[model samples]
Target: MREHYRDFLIRNWEKGDRTRAAAVISYVLSEYGLGWEPNDADRDVLQVEEFYLATGGEFWVIEHQSQIVGTGAYYPINRGEKAVEIRKMYLLPSVRGIGLGKYLLQQLEAAIANRGFQQIWIETASILVEAVKLYESHGYQPETGVETARCDRVYVKYLD
Candidate 1:
């Protein structure tokens, strides 16, 4: 990759990064036709930050070309079950086919593995065909079969 194309970096999200994070969420909401309002995206950004800061979850932002284009976080879902949930994986609309999503997924997998999380779970809308495909492409399989939180399909991945 050229120097400019090599500008992508994933780092811990800071409080000051809310605006950038919101931008990525908005892109996701829009691309998936989620109809999320600006306030909703902003609120989610705060929630993500709080999740990471409070429970020691990992929140990451992908900065490409000096802009936040992708994001994902992992948080404990069931300590007794030795599992963690991967949440809010998003890539901007414009950067969809450029391999950024794969990079983000790889980073999340590495982070979760390093943290000793035995299982990784993800819940995404059933209508989100692309997201579902992404998860399935990454070795995630359907673990749960009910619609929840406004009709979403939940999936799980086990790490070796």
Candidate 2:
């Protein structure tokens, strides 16, 4: 079936969204030839509402026809830090190139800025060229360090 941008609704992650969120994330990761490790921080997203809310951050999902097609979140990198890390930002292929990723990034940036964050950080794999390009195109600058086993590219965006 065909879907339009307006058919998707972005909303806060509720208890019921855990399963679908995980599924969507897993699917996207797998599509990139990446396996979802049980210990990954994203696996804990199912229970991270308190962490996000307590840290003046939030997690959101894009739903279409009651199914989650995309997901993203941001949380303080550490206590008292003015920086937050963007996490779990992924969208199904069916919804890519239609402005959904940009929409989510814009929304996340606004939320983080409104919450007093001064910068946003993101870690991504070089294999995902499109994602890296998207971040760079949106003003995120490449940075050294902050590499993970799976994510080697680190980017930072300072908000004015």
RMSD of each: 3.6, 3.6
* Candidate 1 TM-score to native: 0.83
**Model 2 over residues 1-160: C-alpha lDDT tens digits?**
1223577988888888888888898888899998876576465576666667666678888888888999889888852248998988999999999888987888889888888898899989988888998999999998888646788889999889
TM-score of each: 0.83, 0.90
Whole-model lDDT, candidate 2?
0.83
Model 1 accuracy (lDDT, Cα): 0.73
| Range of the 10 consecutive residues with the lowest summed lDDT in candidate 1 | 1-10
Query: Could you give candidate 1's per-residue lDDT for residues 1-160 as a string of tens digits?
Result: 1112256777888787787787777767776677655454235467765666578688887777677877888888763267887777887777777777777787788888888888888878877777888889989988765433543687788888
Off by over 4 Å in 2: 1-5, 79-81
Tell me which residue pairs clash in candidate 2: none
* Cα-based RMSD of candidate 1: 3.6
